[model samples]
Target: MKKKIGLYFGTFNPIHVGHLIIANHMVEFSDLEEVWFVVTPHNPFKKKSTLLDDYHRYDMVYEATKEYPKLKPSNIEFKLPQPNYTINTLVHLEEKYPNKYDFALIMGRDNLKSLHKWKNYEVILENYSIYVYPRITEVENIAVLKNHPKIVEVDAPIMEISSTFIRKQIKAGKNIKPLLPLTVWEYLDKMNFYR
Candidate 1:
């Protein structure tokens, strides 16, 4: 049987409990063998000034996932071309892994609203599956995604926490241990990051 790997693509400025909860829930309930945290170097929608260095974000994900064997960290975007598009990454994964594994893009319902604006999104809709978890957003725009064979709604909790919030907390010198993993918090402190 081909291994089903769900690609949880994100910048992961700092890997936190919410991310772990969602990934773990998806792996157990969504028939995914593993969920890889694909650290995006630069997201088109995000401002670069607010984002951390790509390697720093990647290493944080790496350390945070050490205890969860089913959770893997991937810096695949670093090797790819600039302005890493989801379609391009998926196509490359298809070529690299071939019949060995099957990949599904895991995202939030929030992303579904902007799916149409992405590069070659039509191809992604037709070729691969998408797993979407609920988020506090208007979903009327994604009507086409509703009940689609290739689209699965993940029954996972929607954590309101975000990287922006975490970064702000760190800058304020507020204790954020309850928000993230211990290893990730310690790693951030060691690097003297955000403050």
Candidate 2:
């Protein structure tokens, strides 16, 4: 049987409980054999100023996912150029891990709203499957992409938590234990991150 891997790519400035929750749920409910947290070196659409150093972010992810064997922290994008685009990463994975694993792009509904603006958007829609979870925004525009053969709308638990919120709490010296995994909180506290 072929392995089905879901690539859950994000900046993950600091991994949190919500991210882990989603990954666990994806594996429990979906056909995915494993979910790799493909840490993007830089997100083209997001501002660079708010991002933590790539190594720090990668370490935080590693710490957060250590307990979950199915959740992997991948630095595949680290070796790629800056301002990494999703299509390029997907293509690279396909070529590098050919036939060994079938892949899908897992993202939130918020990302789907801007999918058309991405580089080689059409090619992505034509080639890879997209598994979308609900975000703060409703899936209003999703009807536009429903016709795409590779699209799969998944109803996963939606957590209102965000990295920005967690960062703000840390900067304010507020406790973020409720928002993040215990291990990640410990790592952040020990490193004095966001202070």
Candidate models: Cα lDDT each: 0.89, 0.86
Query: Worst 10-residue stretch by lDDT in candidate 2?
Result: 139-148
- Per-residue C-alpha lDDT of model 2 across residues 117-165, encoded as one tens digit per residue: 9999988888788888888767666677866678777789988988988
Off by over 4 Å in 1: none
TM-score of 2: 0.95
Compose the digit string of candidate 1's lDDT tens values, residues 1-195: 999999999999888899999999999998998999999999988888878899999989988899999999999889998888998899889888889998899999888888989999889989888998887663774678778889988889988888889999999999988998888999899999889
> What are the root-mean-square deviations of the candidates from the true structure over C-alphas?
1.1, 1.2
In TM-score terms, candidate 1 sits at 0.96
lDDT, candidate 1, at 189: 91
For model 2, what is the alpha-carbon lDDT of residue 10? 91
Q: Which candidate number has the best lDDT?
A: 1
- Model 2 spans > 4 angstroms off: none
Error of 1 at 91 (Å): 1.3
Which prediction has the highest TM-score against the true structure?
Answer: 1
